[model samples]
Structure formats: C-alpha cells, structure tokens
Target: MNGGTDLLGVVSSLLGPGGGSAVDPVEAAARVAWSALVEPGDAVGGLLVQGLGAERSFALVRAAVDDGPELLVESCRDAGLPGAESPSVLTGAVAEALARWGPRLGRVDVLAALDAARAVGARLLVPGAAGWPRAVDDLGPHAPIVLWTRTGRRADGPAVAVVGSRANTVAGAEATAEITSVAADRGCTVVSGGAYGIDATAHRVAVAAGTPTLAVLAGGIDQLYPAGNFELLRNVARQGALLAESPPGTRPTRWRFLARNRLIAALGAATVVVEAGARSGALNTAHHAAQLGRSVFAVPGAFSSSASVGCHRLVAEGRAQIVVHPEDPVDTVLGRSRHATPGRGRSSSSGTPVLAGREDPEVLRVLDALGRRALGEQELAARSGMSFAEVADALALAELQGLVVHGVGGWTRA
Candidate 1:
C-alpha cells in the first residue's frame, strides 16, 4: 500500500471494528495532526478547521509549507471564512500565527499520536462523536480539535465542576468533599482538573460515592501531572474519564494549563468555586463558565480568610450565586435534588418555594420519590403510583415552575 493508504489504515485501526458513532478515521487523524501542529487555543487553526473541513484544512497547511502561510490566509478569505474582522487585522493575525505554527509543521505525526493513544486505550473524540459533550460547542473557534478520552462509559448525567485554590484551607477541602458527595450521590458526574486541594477532594469524594468523575488534564493522557494525585486520577479513569486535547507524552506547560481551564468550564453544567484566592486559576474556570452561560456558584468562606477573596468578589459583583449548603437551589438547576442535604431547613436560606408552596399533589409525589437521587420517568411513575404520562406531565410542570429539574439522569426535585 502507498503511504497515504498506510496512514489511513493505521488511523482507522485505532477506532476498531463496530466502533459505533466514531468519526471517520482519516478526518480524526487530521484533527490529531492539527492538535500537534498548533498550541492549544490557536485561533488560526480553529478558523481553518471551522471554514474548511479538517482534511482540506490539513492539506492546506501541508501545502503552505512550500507556498507560504500567506497563501492559506488568502485561501480562507476566498472561501469566505474571514468574518467581520477587517482584512488588515486578519492579515497581521495570520502572519503572527504563521510564525508560531510554521516551526511545528514538521513535528506533526498523526499516525504516531494515534498509535500512542491506542496503546493507552484512549479514543479520539471529534465534535460529532457519540458521547461528545455539546457544551464545549460554546467555545466556537476556541473549541479543542479533538479530545483524547479514556472512559469506562459515557456518563448518563451532566457534570458539575468543583474548582478552587491549590493552596486551599481545611474548610475549603471539607466543603469540596461535602458538596461533591451530595452532587455525586444525586447522580451528577463530578469534573475537575487533577490538581491538589479542592480539585483532588472533589474527585476522591465522587469516586468514593460510585459517581462518574472526569479529570481534564493539562498534559497528555499518558502523562498525568501533580504525581501526588496519581492514584486518585487512576480511580477516576476507571470510574469515569480522563480527558485531554494533547497527544501522548506532551508535558504540561503554564499556557496549556490556562487553556485547559476552558474545557473544565465547558464540560460542566455549572461550576462551583469552593475557595479561591485573588487571581486564582479557579477564577479563570469560573469566567469561562459564566461566558458559556452556565451557572457559577461560590462557597463563602470566613471574611478573614485570604483564600476566599475571589469567591467574595464574584458574589459581590453578582458574577456568582452564594452557595452555603449542599441543598441550595443551584443544584436543582443542574437536575440534582435541592433537598439532598440532611438538614436543609436548618439553614434559613432554604430559598423561595416553587409555585409558592402550593404545588400539585402529583408533582409533590414525584418530587418526594425523587429525593436526592435521579429517577427515570418509568421509575418515577412506578414509585409515585402515577402513569407515565402523568409523571411526564408532572415533571414538565414542576420544571417549568422551578420545583424540579430534568437532565440526562432523568428527574430530580428542585
């Protein structure tokens, strides 16, 4: 076979036979090539892949090696890929990007990366893959070319990220574990960077609770960082997923970590900051979550605590809602039970009642049956002694009234 056919075969073999809903192997290989060709969050790479298909874009980049990157820019403009940005601005941006990307061109070996991923039992998930999260689409031009994932199964529920300072206080650690336990027990997948303090606490608690947990890494799937959290990350991989945009053996850099924050924020339905100092990386994730229109919650620490300035600022600026207890209504919005906390009413901020405390008896029955755990429509119907249609009707009304929420895991009380 020729080199082109040989490359395609190697790519296709990684996905294996009967890999349902996996992307075309050739296109997937091109994406892996792009991931290595440019740094994370490379806008130029994003535009090329977005405007032209990945295969065509890869061909253009390869052609540019001899023809000059300027030709690629002109081709993009000719293809009507340049939107709104003035030609002069686009010209300079493309020029600067070319300087950065050109040197890396020779280093891209799609087949080697694909082989590395296969060796590690990882799969390349492109945009249309069966279990790709729809939330990251919010990044637009900044979305990852592909995600390298090692997962046991696709989580049935949406995740909630718990992020905070690496130098977190004891209170912050306790808070992370508490909130994670509640969220996981209610069938929410827990997501976090595999870092120390709060991120580690969140992953550990979620794994212990038998809930799916995803650790979005700054490096490659093969090179887990922070070495101290190796065991925890391994458990996370077994129970949930280890996701990265980088190929195998890539080292974590400062810029890569910053770029990695976007994925964590985009993956979660909501992000909760347990404790963060001023200018913390957790704040970066919170900003990304806010930009994606996802809920941001801050756990308030003592006013005297230096580790909480970011959280306080977020709350005061109205960028985040204050979450003092596990049962706060924010969890409900993500389809976790708002009544999950053992002593919810003990705190005065039980939040306003849904429908002014005069809910329909059928809706109330479903909510009671839901408790803190997720229940599918049929299970809810069985437990509530209501028909499937009645349960559906009740769930819809309750969700509309803010009394309950329904997500991939089914339904839960609000």
Candidate 2:
C-alpha cells in the first residue's frame, strides 16, 4: 500500500481491541502517521480512533462523536493531523498519524484547509463573493475560516446588526423594532445572531418590512441552538440566510458563542447595541465591530436600567456613537451634511437663486406633517391640503430644490 493507504490501514488496526497501552510504539507511530493523511471525504471511523488515542485522543473522539464526521475532520485538520477513514482504527493511530504528518503538515495552510473543507460538502466564503459580507472581512485574522451556509439566497446588501441582552426591557424591544424598521425601509439588511431579545426583534421587524436579514448561528446551520428560535431561524433562512462556520450537526458551545460575535460585527456595516448589561455578550459584538473599524452605535437607555449600562460605557469611551434614534444611525453612516449653512426655501416667484436657508412656514408644515416616515404623493396631498397637481409640483420642486428627499416607496423630509 502507498504511504497514505498503509497509514489508513494501520490506524484502523490501532483502533481495534488490545491496541491500548499494550500497543507497540512503532505501531502507535504508524497510527499517528495515518491521521496526517486525512483529507476531505475520508471516512470517519479511523479518524475517530486516531483522534481518541489510548488516552487523551480517545476521550476527545468520544466527546465529539455526536459532532459528526465533518466536524471531526475539521478538528483534526485544525490540529495539523489527518483523520481516520474508518471507525476500526486503533486508539494509538492518532499519535502515529500526527508523528508521520507533523513534519510535512506545513503544506496544510489556510488555503489548503479551505480546499479540504470544500471537498467535504462545505462551501467556503471569502470576502468579495456575491454573498461575502464586508463586515466579516473587517475582522482581520480573527474572522472565521469560512462561513458554511445553506440558504437559497445569499444576502447582498448593507446590513445593520442589532444586538442586546437576552433579558431586555420592553422599551428595548420596541426600540429594536423601530430601528430595524428604519434600516429596512432605507434598503439596509439586518444581521443578528438569532438570539432572543433585540436580535430576534430586529429580524422580525426586518422581515415584516420586506427586507433581507441574515442570522449567524454559533451552532451548525442545520442545528438551531436555542430551540426557541428554530421557527424564527427557518423564517430568516427563507427570507435571507442562516450562516455558520461549523459544519452541520455541531452543537453550540460557550466558546463558539463568543467567537460568533466577531462574525456578527464583521457582517454588518454598523452594529447597534440596543440594550446590554455591563457585561452582556452584546458588548463582545461591539468590541469586534470597533476592532474591525466598523461603526458601532449604541442606543442610550435610562440611567437606572442595567441593560443600558454597556451602551453608555461604549459611548462614553468613544468606542461607539450615541444614536438617539434610528435616523441618527442612518445619518452617521451616510455622513454628515457637507454644507454647514442651513437650507433656504424656494421662492414662489420666478428668478430666485437656490441657496441654503430656512424653509417657509408652508413648506415646513408640509414636511412636518410628512414626518420621518415616507408619505405617498396622494397621502402628502391629503395631509398638506394641497391640490393633487400642486402637491406633485411641490414634491417635484422640493426634490429638485433640495427641501425633501425621495426614496423607493415614497418621500421623506430631508
């Protein structure tokens, strides 16, 4: 047999009975050598044995048995070793595989790792792909190896991540919805971790607004962690996508949750912390965003509310922008007005210079009635008591005159 095939057989043998501590060192070395040959699509039986050595590797394999073969291979590959191709490998095979491959494992760089992952049915997403989130690339090296996604449509728009504490207040939930609604209406996707509280509210509102939203999960894409969010996650998958770095069937763990925060931050143009305690996990997302150079905004709550403490600290430390409302976030991202001078109203008479100045009372009233929410032409006519033709003329003039802004569904005050 070739080195690779021979190593595979030896690993299988070491995994069998009597291959425990009684196994010969040379046989054990061969078993370890076999593990180094693991590539994507290899069987898991031998790999499992190689991973669970006579002692340490054994327990590790047993503990991870439920994680599935893909995850096992990933773990092995990450450890710079090969995984067994079958279950019958001796317990000592893992050490042997490691020893054999240890010297030449330098070839298994990140690119090779990605190739291996793809060979095993997992898709590798890099920055600049149609579905590649700009937010994630901002994470630098801390970013995930690859995002394993299983959705029909990949998200392809600017996304605002809404994160907060699980035990959020009623006001926090309301704010999350309102902010998410604003984002959706403005053509921004919403990204969250599919957790309870603010994350769930953001996704719900974004969906209601007919906007795409993405959910990053700490567990496998196929496995929903918080069982409570299974249905919600399904809806997100239909409307947007559910992304995970781990292969399917991997369970969520505490470390995974922490690492997942960086993904959330990197996937968004900006992150808004609606509510979080002093030490809430949401803060981790904010930190990741700041580190990635993405905008981090925080909604301030009452001084007495524990949930708002983290946000307050973030803003005070200059790590985040203080967003009193959703518009503040939008404006921050779009940038401040270049002209310092105030805008002027258009003259009713012909031959007037268009300059930055205050608007007339009539125009102000019309805009005030329109509010921040978009109003259709007919709605604006009815609200402003202007004739249909006059409203159309006014709206057209307002847009050209820079008194108001036009958007997809309707018009909103500039």
Sequence-dependent TM-score of model 1: 0.77
Question: What's the true lDDT of residue 161 in model 1?
Answer: 83
Q: Which stretches of candidate 1 lie over 4 Å from their true place?
A: 1-3, 16-22, 329-332, 335-414
Point out the worst 10-residue segment of candidate 1 by lDDT: 341-350
Report how far off residue 37 is in candidate 1 (Å): 0.8
Across 131-197, the per-residue lDDT of candidate 2 in tens digits comes to: 5455554444244433556454556656778899888999899888888888887777789999988
Candidate models: Cα lDDT each: 0.75, 0.59
> What overall lDDT, based on C-alpha atoms, would model 2 receive against the true structure?
0.59
Q: Roughly what TM-score does model 2 have, to 2 decimal places?
A: 0.53
Each prediction's TM-score against the native? 0.77, 0.53
Among the numbered candidates, top lDDT falls to 1
Residue 313 lDDT in candidate 2? 70
